[model samples]
Target: MVLKIGDARSMYRKFKPHLLMVLIQLGYTFLNFITEASFNEGLNPYVYITYRHAVSGFVMLPFAYFLERRIRPKLTWPLFVELFILSLLGVGFTLNAYFASLRYTSPTVVASMVNVISSLTFIIAIPLGMEKLDLKNPRGMAKVIGTLASLAGVTLMTLYKGKSFRSIWSAPIHMGSSSIHENWLKGSILGVASCITWSMWYVMQAYTLERYPAQLSLTTWMSLIGGAQSAVFTVCVEHKPAAWIIGFNIKLWSILYGGIVCSGLIIFIQLWCTKEKGPVFVTMFNPLSTIMVAILAYFVLGEGLYMGSILGGIIIIIGLYLVLWGKENDEEEVPMRSS
Candidate 1:
C-alpha cells in the first residue's frame, strides 16, 4: 500500500507526547538556571533546600489525595517499600547531596557533572538488567558516542582553556596566586560526588515507577516523606535560628517558585515522561538544558555566555539528537525488572 504525504504527517503527529516530554526537560533546565541565580542572591542554601522540598511536599499532598487517591492502584507492601526507598534516595539524599555540593562548588561545576547522567544511566541500567546492552549495534554505538560527545561539549563549556588549553593539563595552574589545585579542587570533588548520587536517584526512580506506577501520586508521596527527612537533616546540620528567617522579598519568591513550580511540578512531569518513554529517551534531552541555562544566565543573571559555552551547547544538542535517533530505531524491550 502506498502512503500519502498527509498520511505520513498524520502518523508523525502521534509522537506529540514524546516530543512534549523532551520540551519539558528543556523547561526544567531553563527554570533551574533561574533558580540557581535566585539561590545565589540570599537565603542559606540548606534552608532554601529544606524549604523547597517542604513546599513541594505540602503543596502536592492535597492534590495527590484529591486527584489521584481513588484512581491510584492499591499499594502492596513491596511497592510501598520501593516508594519509601525512592523517596529517601531520589528526593532526600539526592537533593541533600546536591545542596551540600552546591555549598562547596560553583554552578558551572555542578552543571558539567550533571551530564554524567547519560553515561551513568546507560552503564547501570545494563547491570540491573533493566536494559539490554547491544554493543555491536549501530544504534548502541551511537548512544555511547553521542553521550561522550555530549560530555565533551560539557567539558568544553566548563573547562575550555582558550589557547591556554595546555595550561589546564599542566600542574600548579595559578588563579592569580591561589592555585587551581588549592582553591577549585574541593568543588570539583563535590560536583563529581553529586553527579554519582544524582544518577543513583534516577536509577531508583526508574525502578520505583515499575511497581507503583502512578507517577504523580508516587512523586507527591516521595516529596512528602523526603521533605520531612531533608528538613530534619537540615535542622540538625545547617539550620540556625536566623536561617529560618526570611531575609529578602526576592528570596521569598524564589523559594516559592523553586519549590512549587521547579521542584514539585517539574518532578511530576519528569516521572510521567520517563515512565511513558524509556529512561534513555528522557535522558537524551539532558544536554539541551545547557543551551537554555546559558541564555538565561546571560540575560537574567548578567553572567557572560562564553563562546565555548555557546559552541559546546550546540554540539551537545546535536549529540543528544543523535542519541535520540539511535533510541528510536531499537526494538529491544528492557522491562523494568525488580531491582
Candidate 2:
C-alpha cells in the first residue's frame, strides 16, 4: 500500500514522543550502571554534579545560541527569577541529592524509587490545577489507580526477593554489594527526597515553559544557572583539590555522558516532550526504566530474577496501560500566560 506524504508525517509526529521517551529510558538505564561504576571508582557525588552541570551548560550553549537566537524571549525579571528557582530545584539541589543517593544505593534500587515520581507528580499537578482528577471521570480513576498499582508493584519488587536465578552473565564482573542494607536505608531516604524535588521540578518546568516557549534556550539558561549554583556550593564544601580533578578515568566519562546525554540532550528532549504532553505524561514512563534496569541487571550482572520482579513487571505494565488510557482523556490545554 502506498502512503501519502501528509499521512506519513502525521504518523511520525504522533509517535515521536513515545519513541523519544523510550530512548530516554534506555539512556537512563545504561546511565545507572555507568554512574554507579564511577561512584565506586571514588568520584565524589557533589563534585560529579558540579562538573556534570558545567559540562552540560557549556556544551549546549552554542546549540541554543545558534538555533534559538531569533526566537528566544527577552529575559524579563520575573522570568529570570522563576528560571533561577527552577535551576535550584531541578538541577543543583535535585542532582546533588540524586547522585548522593546513587552513591549509597544500587541502580536497581534507585530505579525502583523512580517509580514514585509519577505518583508524586500526579498529586502535585492536581493541586497546581494541571491535572483534573475527578473520581467521577473514568479517566481520573485510571490515572489514580494506575499510580497506586505502579507504586505497589515497585514496593513489592524492592522488598520481596523471592528466589535466586542462575547466572546468565558470561563474564565475572562483580559490581553489586550485598552488605548495602545500612546504606540502602540511607539511600532510600535520599532517593525519596530526590523524587520529591524532581516531581516539583517537573510541575514547575511545565509552568515555566509557557512564558518561555524556546525549549533549547530555556534548557541552556537553566543549565548555566544550575551549574553555577552547584559550583559555588561545591567550592564552599569540597575543600580538596584532588576531588575536583578530572583525570583520564571513569570520572571524566561519567561527567561527559551524564552531562551531554543525560542532562543536556535529555533535558531538552524532556522539555520538548513536557511541552507536547503535560508533565504527568512525561513522568509516567519512569516505571519502564525500572523494568529495563532490572532485566539488564539479570543478564549483565547476574542478579537474580525473582518472582516478585516478574510479577512486579506485569503489574507495572498494566499500570502503564491504565495511565496511557488516562492520558487519552487528558485535554491538551497549555496554561495561559499571566501578565
lDDT of each: 0.68, 0.86
**lDDT of each residue in 1-339, candidate 1, tens digit only:** 256877878776657546776677666665554445555554566677778778887888888878877678787787777777777776677776665555455455566677877778877777887555567988877877888888889888887634322212233211122112233666567666766766777777777777667776887777777777777877888646877787557568767877887678878888876776666666667666666766655554455567788778888987887777677656333343322
Model 1 gets an lDDT of 0.68
Best model number under lDDT: 2
Runs in model 2 deviating more than 4 A are 4-8, 172-182, 331-339
Candidate that would win on TM-score: 2
TM-score of 2: 0.93
Model 2: colliding residue pairs:
none
- Estimate the lDDT of model 2: 0.86
TM agreement with the true structure for every prediction: 0.82, 0.93
**Superposition TM-score, candidate 1 onto the true structure:** 0.82
lDDT score for residue 9 of model 1: 81
Give Cα distance to truth, residue 85, candidate 1, Å: 2.0
Tens digits of per-residue lDDT, candidate 2, 132-182, equal 787998887998898888888888898997876766557366675534334
